[model samples]
Target: MLVKNISVVAAFVASVCIMPAQAQNNTIVVKANQLKADIQPTMWGVFFEDINMSADGGIYAELVKNRSFEFLKPLAGWTFKGKERKEGDLLILNRQDKQTNNPRFIQVNPNHTAKGDFGIINEGFRGMGIKQGLRYDFSMLYRQPAAGVKVHVELLNAKNEVIGKTTISPVATGKEWRKLEASLEATATEPKGTLAVWFEGSGQMDLDMISLFPGDTWKGRKGGMRADMVQMLADLKPGFLRFPGGCIVEGYDLSQRYQWKKTIGPIEERQLLINRWNFEFAHRPTPDYFQTFGLGFFEYFQLAEDIGAEPLPILNCGMACQFNTAEMVPLDQLDPYVQDALDLIEFANGDASTKWGKVRAQMGHPEPFNLKLLGIGNENWGPQYIDRLQVFTKAIKEKYPKMQLITSAGTDPDGERFDYLNGQLRKMNADIIDEHYYRRPEWFLQNAARYDNYDRNGSKVFAGEYAAQSDKTVSIHNKNNWRAALAEASFMTGLERNADVVVMASYAPLFAHVDGWQWTPDMIWIDNLHVVGTPNYYVQKMFSTNRGTHIVPILKNNAPLAGQDSLYASASVDKTTNELIIKLVNVSANGLQQEIKLDGVSKLSGNARHYVMKASGLDVENSLKEPLAIVPVEEQWKASGKSLKVNLAPHSVNVIRVKHLDLVSFKKAGKME
Candidate 1:
């Protein structure tokens, strides 16, 4: 049944429908002869930010928090276990002057005691997730004055019950630190778990880089990413992976900003920095949060390569976060920052003979990462950013002129800030301007024609970060609901329609942990062991997996079908597959019958494939227990002639792909049979 107040009928009909209301048909005519533009491969991607435990406890497989004893409290995530603490039994020793990179270590002097009588317990980020019958690998760096100390490790479930155990003995006692390793198998599955280390002998020893990782990691790399979580990203087949972060790129202040050079090399030597999100939200304070750099820049590039995506890294523009400090570096003192940007390109793509490139080679990747895109700022705006960007651009262009630079247009997509930056950047001939949007659902519908009036020859656009908000932006109550997802779908049609102007697009704040997230409405939500893609994730996957090579015109009554009668659509043709890809979005609460006509095709198969995603209501969502609550439901569709009729479900997003069998029309478009 159609909505009583709407007429998606004779007004937008194909071939002038003189028929009555009962005979009204939904028709979208695909102009096979009209090719608007070619779609770039980097049209859709995933934006990564190290928020909500996305690194330490979320994706990075390390289970031990404060592994290097580098947090503000040094032992914020660790607790003393067993008998009253003896004097000097555990001491956080700082050698800041000598070991600036990793200045902290724990010294333990245990009395003669049996195993399980004394030690420390590490409460993982939230709690370590353990699985039944899975092996837990533990390793640490240690130094002993004399060799008499032995260590016992235990894995505990959420109930604090021991489920796995192993022991290690250190014999190479000397001035130099030695590494020790052990493994244990868990006997039960638990979402919240802990790791306890017990001492068994009387000896003086020092420990650092204490860690534990599951045997089941991505590709079984000893110290790698979570397999289940990485698989979710691989499933989307994203075109690019934007790394290191949103606000992390621009720290709370310059001193706290993310420095990529400090993140690579031996894991222990990599200096740790406090994660900006640790103190951002007063409502959700996480004082223990910090960047271990275990998942550093090299790992990011490797992950992008593993999933067949281009690497796009963002660098700071010598300015701190505007909302936090708004601190700007002096123009004369910006050399180091500018040099950092220059060195990154060399690190990513320069030859091994180069300094930074040699460092990249030592980390195990000799071949260049083929870096093509670099963003200058996170959300900084005004003449200050422009001034800093100019210096970096002038230096980088002189050295690496071919590199494409992505400039910021501020936090909001449109405002005095955005307008000022947009005009200035365009005047300067910037390559790509990044635009972000986190607004209500109504805003999405209203701006569906945003890029329609953009200059066709100006700097290209990158919808760098955008998501339709169910509640106010940054509110704790915001949800990843169908209403927001559906609105995003309707707006995305405009992006696809303007593919010539928009080269790259991605949703922001990609992953969130259920127990630790400070922000809501993330694309994917994770618990200890399970991962669930929200309604928004499925919507992005549908558009990405079906994005064709070239855009084709899809019209209704000689006008672009955008928010007309509550309908939005875009069409494309895959030259390689010789198939027509059509996307239709129906935001109304009533089903509308659609008749799609292949205008130039004299003969074509009526059979097609329909991928439909619809939920019972806008507020319905997916949870860990019901991960597939809103996934795309695939159906085999068949009609009889040139027109195919599909019933667009109430508040649904649909994708239809049909093979063009007409040789004449196919050859006319330069596509073979």
Candidate 2:
């Protein structure tokens, strides 16, 4: 049935009804020849933050928990047992002076002479997932004071039966730490398996950084990211990846900030720190949460390279998280923090002869990553941030003038703090300004034209971290539902329409473990064995994969079609493929029967394809049990001449791609035929 709202119909007729032959003004006219602006290649991207167990337990893929024995409770994830007794066998040793960052290591001391197999069993993050025939790499740092000390490693199933086993014998009786490595092939598949290490010797031994990794990691490198999670990101073909962010870049305190230098280098040597989200929320208190830096700066850059994305790494400014400690590094002692930014650029794009570049080469990636963009801070505000940012920009531009820096505009999209920072950034002539928004679905829907009047000549905008909140910001009840995703899609059409002003955008908190999450509504959610892409993920994928080169004017009647009869539209043409990609969003609860008229184009081929993502209900969500519940549905479409009637489903995002054929050339070819 046609929508009968008087205001809506009149608005549609006043804008869309161009030809008198058509009685109703229900057509969307797209000016194929009128190029509006050039679409940015990095307009759509993904933001990754370490909140919600995203790194350690979600995507980094290390199977051992508390690997460095650095958790507040050193043996939080491990259970000790002796062959005869279960008491006072395992001890945590700490060396405050030598290993300040990693001060603790587990030491196993049997009854001095009566030990069959006394060791500790580790319950991995929720439990390790083991598959038959797959190889698992196990490594640990060990030191023995006496000879004949052996460490027996085994992968055990849920039923307490061993599926894989390896042994590491420390023959040298010295205090020097020696690295032990072994690989175990599982004989059976188990989704919630555990790792057991038994020490059967007459001597005491110390171990630290007990680690296990799947051999089939992304790029097949040991101590690498999970293959499945990275593969999901790679499939999106994102133009850029914004990494190590949200609040993590600005730690709860200055000392806890995300230090790129500490995150790089060897995995074992990387300092372990308590994650800010460990006790942030009362609803989900994860005391075991910590940053092992296993998925550090190098891995983030590597992941970006593997996925064909430009690396946009955000560094910490002098000011810490404003909501927490709001600590600030003294201006006199801020050289080291600024130096980290300079060194990071070298590590990413410098030659092997450079100091930082040598570290990158030693890590096995000899080639530079060709870094172009760097973010100065996460969501910082106030004069302190501005002072620090001024120093950073002056120093960085002095060295690398061509490098683009993204400055922050506080947290809220439109407030006193945001206004102050935004104005200051513009006055400072910053290359790009990053803005974040975590608002309600209705707010997103209403703000579709937020940037329509932005100053195009000023610094470009980066919708750095944004996700439509279904319930409330940081609320446990907030969900990644179709409602939020649909609203975001609508808002994104506006962003694409003003592509010249909005250079880059990404969704926040990219990954979340279903059971270990501190934040809700992440793009992707995972469990012990399965990964699920939320409706928001598909929406982002649709916009990114189909993003064309240049924008074409798409109008309903004489006005831009933004929230007209609950419809939003944007069209762009790909110079490479000569294809017109038109995106449409129907926010209304009822279906839309709209005719799209192509103008100024002499001919358009009948060949077309429509990629759509719609959910049955607004509150519906995708889960590991039903991962495809809200995924894209592709269908072949045909257009006659320059007009096509499209039936857009309720609350849906559609990308329609049609071949733009040259009519004059086609006619000449037809005459020869």
Compared with the true structure, the alpha-carbon lDDT of candidate 2 equals: 0.84
**Best prediction by TM-score:** 1
Off by over 4 Å in 1: 1-25, 660-673
- Residue 389 in model 2: lDDT: 94
Model 1 Cα displacement at 246 (Å)?
0.6
Taken over the whole model, the C-alpha lDDT of each candidate is 0.86, 0.84
Please estimate how well model 1 matches the true structure, expressed as its whole-model Cα lDDT: 0.86
Candidate 1 lDDT tens digits, 231-334: 98998889999988899989999999989888889888888898989999999888888899999998999899999898999998999999999998999999
- Expressed as tens digits, the lDDT of each residue in 643-671 for candidate 2 is 87888987789999998544332111110
- TM-score versus the correct structure, for each prediction: 0.95, 0.93
Error of 1 at 68 (Å): 1.1
